[model samples]
Structure formats: structure tokens, C-alpha cells
Target: MVNSVPDCDFTADYLTATEADNLLAHCLTALPWQQEDILLFGRTVAQPRLQVWMGEPDAVYRYSGTDFVPVPWDAQIRALCTRLARDCGTRFNSVLCNLYQHGQHSMGWHADDEPELGPEPVIASLSLGHARRFVLRPRAKGNPDRHEWSLGHGDLLVMRGQTQQHWLHGIPKTRRAVGPRVNLTFRRLLGAEVSAGRAESAEIDVG
Candidate 1:
């Protein structure tokens, strides 16, 4: 469950199936989930899926042309982060929780290269519920190669070092009928103040 690519680590069963199911259920009911809008092509539009941003007080993250001040983490999430950090050997102060309600909901190709993430950020992504295809491709030309992995329930993937500098990763939309999936990407934000400035867009809550 490891990759030859430097700084890329994958664990197929980071959590037991029962543990993953319990955690997913807790997050669905406890976390404050919201469907955000991003400014794309000069017009704001809804994000493809629902998400909940949770972090420490200073770990506000900004991306997709919007600033997100994370809500405080739930106790379960904090404990899970502690365990994940210990296993991954990197501390995490923030997390972005994404819930794809069905096959059509997905995340497009993008890199986690926000300024607040600093250089060479370590991102630990945990997946639960339905399995989905996670893809990565090189940004540079002449390396027409693609890497794909089936991120299954309770799987964990860690990307670090120059992974973000040279690669893009995402979960593409699928037409097959699939159940909901929950993904949590843990991050460590560099020094930055939490700003009240919010992007001019609407937030749709489907709770």
C-alpha cells in the first residue's frame, strides 16, 4: 500500500471497517457541514460537494478564491487527528472534510498549494464509506504518466515534500450509482491571522 513516488504514502486499512463506520456516522451528525461556493470565471458557483472545515484557532485556510475560518474541531476529530499525526509523524492543525453524496459529486483536478500551507506541506487524507478512484498526474510535460488508486473505506494517503510542487491530485466524477463517501484531509497551516473577510458567495447547507 505504498507508492514508489517519493514522499507519497498510502495505507489501505488505516482504520478498521467498524471504526470507520462509527466515525463516519458521528461526523455526519455532529460536524457543521456546508456546501460552499467558489469564484470561478468571475462568477460564484456551488462547490461540487459538501464540506466542513475544522481546525485550531490559528489554522485558517484560504483556497478556491475564498477564505475559510474553520470551526473548532469536535472531540472525536481531535482525538483522531492526534492518532493520525503520530502515525504519519507530522503534526496537523486543520482538516477539510468533504462528503460526496452520490456518484456525481466530486473534486476536480487541483493542487493543495495555498500560500498559507507553506512550502512542502504534509497532507494526510483519510477516506471512509464508499471507495472512489483517486488520481494523480504530473504537471510538467513529457511525463505523460498517471497514477490511480482506489481509496477505500478507512484508507489513508499522505502526500508530502515536492508532491504538491509537481503533481495534481483529485477525485473525478463517476456515473455509476454509488453511496456517499467522506474524506478528511488534515493539514498544518503556516503562520497567518484569521481574517473576517469572506468571499462574496452563497453557502448552501444541506444538513
Candidate 2:
């Protein structure tokens, strides 16, 4: 079941409609959503969507050359993490929350291949609210392989094994009118440590 797509797993209905609706509403108001500045092509630009990092205190994540300290876990998110750990068979310790306010709020192509994730990281992504298109392509140039999915409410997509080592994924900006959506990606950091120095730029994105 976990190998539905070459190191990826897609569960169409991980959460019931009622559960998704309630979770989405809670996240919209309960979580502290904020736009962050990211380094891109030698320039600092605001990330297109609002995001919050939540997890254990030691799970400091570095993305797009920025080190983010995890916020204290809320009861709701902790419960969800427990459920995902059991169901996905991975002890996830952190979650990145992304809020896409509309069609214009999108993520660019990037791999979740940070050093803290270790080799062959397992990432479980749960989607709620409006449906959106997710695209994946091989990192190797000129590769013809590509995959796409319409991740709607209650869907759970898990990427594990060597997926991050070989593929880049993103949510492209859409012109069609769309409502708000939330995505929670749960992961386990391997010996995460806080760093003193900061870099200027690197490829990073949330999905």
C-alpha cells in the first residue's frame, strides 16, 4: 500500500469529511500563520503562503537558508502526530503547517532533502480544504517521467525511501479561483541541532 507511486503512497481518504472540516477550521484560526522571507536567486522575497513550524523543541529546521525553531506543539497537532505515527509506521517528531489563502499562494519546486532529515526520509503530507494540483518530476535533467495528483480534502500523501533524492515536487500557482487550504507535513528529524550561522540562499518549499 505504501508503494503506490515509486517510493510514494497516496491515500485518498485518510480523514473523514467531518474530521477534515473541523481540523481545517481549527488550523485557520488557532495556528499562528505568517508569511516569511525566503532567499531566491540571490534576492530575498516573501514566501507566497503563510506557514508555521510546530514540533518538539529540538526539531530545529533549516530551509531556504533560514533556521526555524519549532513552536510548542498544540494539543490538536500532537494528537494528529500520534495518529500519523501509528498509521504511517514512522515516529514523526515535527510538522510544517502551510496555509494557502488562494490560488496564487503556491510552493515552488524543491526537495525535502535537508541534512537533518538523513537519508531516505519519510514525509507524510495531509491536505485539507480546497483541492489543488501537485506535480512531481525527476531531478535528472531531460527526464521524461512526471506525475501529478489532485490532492483534495482528507487526502494523505506519503513520500518515503529515495523519493526526495531523485524527485522535485511543488504546487504551482493556479489562475482559477480557489478557497483557502491547509497542508500539514509530518517528519522525523534525525539528531537535529541548532546552528549559529545563517546562509543566504538555497532551494526550499512546502507542500
TM-score winner among the candidates?
2
Candidate that would win on lDDT: 2
Q: Superposing all C-alpha atoms, what RMSD in Å does each candidate have to the true structure? A: 5.1, 3.4
Encode model 1's per-residue lDDT on 1-207: one tens digit a residue: 223364688998899988999999988788888999886656778998999989898777555467788899899889999999999888999899999999888887777776667679999999999999988877676766788899999999999998877877778888899999999999998776533223321222211
Instruction: Tell me the deviation in Å of residue 93 in model 2.
Output: 0.7
Error of 1 at 136 (Å): 0.2
Q: What is the clash tally of candidate 1?
A: 0
**Model 2: ten consecutive residues of lowest lDDT:** 194-203
Q: List lDDT for all candidates, in order.
A: 0.82, 0.86
What are the per-residue Cα lDDT tens digits for candidate 2 across 45-102? Answer: 8999999999999999666657788899979889999999999998999999999999
Question: Between which residue pairs do clashes occur in model 2?
Answer: none
Error of 1 at 133 (Å): 0.5
Cα error, residue 151 of model 2, in Å, equals 0.5
Clashing residue pair totals per candidate (backbone < 3 A): 0, 0
Q: List where candidate 1 sits over 4 angstroms from the true fold.
A: 1-6, 194-207
TM-score of 2: 0.91
